[model samples]
Target: MNGLFGENLKYDLKASLVVFLVALPLCLGIAVASGAPPMAGLIAGIVGGIVAGSISGSHVAVSGPAAGLTVIVLDSISSLGGFQLFLGAVVAAGLIQLILGLVKAGVLGYYFPHSVIKGMLTAIGLILILKQIPHALGYDKDHIGDMAFEQMDQHNTFTEIYYAFIYNSPGAIPIVLIGLLILFLFEKPKIKTHKLFGIIPGPLWAVIAGILINETYRFWIPGWQLGGDHLVSIPELTSLGDITSLLTFPDFSLIADPNFWLVAFTVAIIASIETLLSVEAGDKLDPYKRITPASRELVAQGTGNMLSGFIGGLPLTVVIVRTTANVSSGARTKMSAIFHGFLLLILVLAIPGLLNKIPLSCLAAVLFLVGYKLANPAIFIKEYKKGFDQFLPFILTVIAILLTDLLVGIGIGMVVGLFFVIKTNFHRSLVVTELNGNYLVKLQKDVSFLNKAPLMKQLSTIPPGSNVVLNAVKARFIDHDIKELLDDFIETAPNKDIEIILEGFSNHVRQKA
Candidate 1:
């Protein structure tokens, strides 16, 4: 343990605290969104940090209860008849994921185009900024981790922002603004080098400052104070007994139920997809540019969910928001993720009251910066310069995700990307070059029916007196359609006074009447 983490311990410790702060509210919010006990979210967060972090190959990704699974879990719990039955489904789902990893199904991530992946990241960035605007203004109707365009609160992303503008909280505005300033100040070179400020990251100070300001409001400016829903709202635990009571084990009797298996299969497929996508996003954001084994990540996530269900917890996945927070915080190793789990455990046990004082607006400011870093205008410009083949898919992905959800948006982008791939291949299959009334039509490799129209067009344009050479030596296979086109062109050559020469095609092309 010392050898792996000793060199990066200091960096990881700071990063861990930042991730813990980011994960805390998200965990609770996702639990509420999933219609499960708040303690379940915390348990999943803890296990993801400790068990998944320990078992996974990723250096900076932090796993926890994912927003993507909220709708599935909420509906599944009711369909399965109870939360205990749902817990059984979660355990079974984990086992299915384990089997998928062993079968190397993780390679599905590799088939996605890079442009689509970038689009997914950029979309999440935009979503973070758009979603947090309401929270920053103290509109707490929607949970913090909800990523879908449409919210369960009957407000879409834009509508929520519109409503926030009208009913903004006065106290939260200043706290968020002040928090942003503090975070910006801490990022300055001189402040970062400060003996004390540099050691502890800026987010901790921002949370602390928010607490002090809110407390001051309570005493002197009661009208502008934030409490209840505006605060962190961690489940209070006064004794060790309170902690044990929250734990709920899975009902093993559900193992024989078909409904249980249906829910388990759905959870396993979705969780694996989310994990694969999140890992792709995480690897892109890592400063070290390290690649993680996708199959191993599946195994790690499976292990975490199994353990979480064995006790009481929500389903777990490699969450993009928390993973982004960890990478943006300069996490150096997996210890940061593991330590963040321990911090969550400690928060629930010893300091729920203290953490509860943190204003949600303050955390909003932190995410705002993370969002800006991701969706910077420069990224758009860079992708646009790559041409329509890349830019089209990238922009489409961002729009699709913004309008729909992550998986659907990515699927749309992939279809567009595949279209471009076929279009490019169609054009490049056969090369046509002309010199001084003579033409060399070279087929480089396989020429399929998709390229037949272009090949015919090129062959038809040869002048009446021109000499044409059809080169097929390099082509390993020519579709029957292409061979027929060549035969027709050859038979008509004498009438136009066009000379036809075929190289390495005597066996394939026959003269036709």
Candidate 2:
């Protein structure tokens, strides 16, 4: 244990604390969005960090309750009758994922296009910035938007800005401005090398500042004070017995229920895809450039969910926001992720009141930086410069996800991307170069049916009284449709008063025509 973590234990400790802070509000927000018990998200966060991190192949991919699965979970709870019954579906989903991992089905994650993944992240970042604006202005809503355009509140995402502008809190605006300033200065080259600011993480100081600012309002400046509704609300645990009571077991009798199987299958597939993409994203951010073992990821996620379900936790997946925060904080090993779990467990039990005093606005500031890093304008420009093929799919993905859901958005992008792929292949199949009043037709080694229309169109443009040369010396495979077209063209050559020439044609092909 020491060998794997001891070399950079200090760095891991710093990163863990930063990640823990960033994850706290998101966990609470996602749980609220899912319509489960508030503690359910916390439980999933702990298990994901401890169990999944312990076994996961990637050093920085952190698992927890995902916002993407919120809609499915919400609907399942209603369809399956209640939260306890829904736990059964989660358990079933985990078992199915275990089977999939055993069969090496995790590689399905690799088939997704890179442009689609980047667009997915970019859309999430834009959503993050847009949604957090309300919290940053202190809207004081119990249910925060969970990184989606179609919010859980049944309102479009733009409504959040309306709420922020109308219901803005005086106390929070200052705290957020101060928090953002602190983060900005902390990142500056001058402040980074300072003796004190360099050692302690910027997030810890931000939390402390938030706490102090709110406390000042609560006591000394009661005239403009903020209420508890505006702060983080972690349920306080008064006794050791309180911890055990939070655990809830699933009703196993639902195993025979067909509806349970349907929900389970849906969750398993969606969770697997989200986890795989997050793992790939984390790998891109790895300074060491190491590839994660994809198969091991499925096993770890299945194990975490099984345990989480048994204990009344929300579904778990690798989350991109926290994963990016982990990278930003300079996490070196999986120990940083595991340690963050332990920190979550300790703090939720030890000082729920202290945590509750933290204003959501400060946390929003932290997330704003993370969001901008993911959706950098420089990246968008670079993608555009690559070519329209890459940029178009990326733009489509971002727009679709911003207006609809994740799966649908990615599907739209993939379809657009596939069209470009087929188009490029069509151009390469057969070449027609005209010279000296004659047309030279050079067929490539392999040609598919997709090229037939283009090939036929080019052949038709051969003006009357012109010569034609057909070359297939390097051809290996030709579709029957293409051969038929060539045969028909050859037989009708006399009608157009055009000469016909065939070079390197197969004897059988020559004889058949």
Off by over 4 Å in 2: 1-4, 463-477, 490-513
- Which residue segments of model 1 deviate by more than 4 Å? 1-4, 252-254, 463-466, 473-477, 483-513
**What are the per-residue Cα lDDT tens digits for candidate 1 across 434-501?**
99999999986778998888888888788899999989888888899998888888888999999878
lDDT of 1: 0.90
Per-prediction CA RMSD (Å): 2.6, 2.8
Top candidate when judged by TM-score against the true structure: 1
Give the TM-score of each candidate.
0.93, 0.92
How much is 9 displaced in model 2, in angstroms?
A: 2.4
lDDT of 2: 0.84
lDDT of 2 by residue, 294-373 (tens): 87899999988899999989989998888988988888888889999999999999989889888888888888888888
Model 2 per-residue lDDT at 71: 88
RMSD of 2: 2.8
Model 2's TM-score against the true structure: 0.92
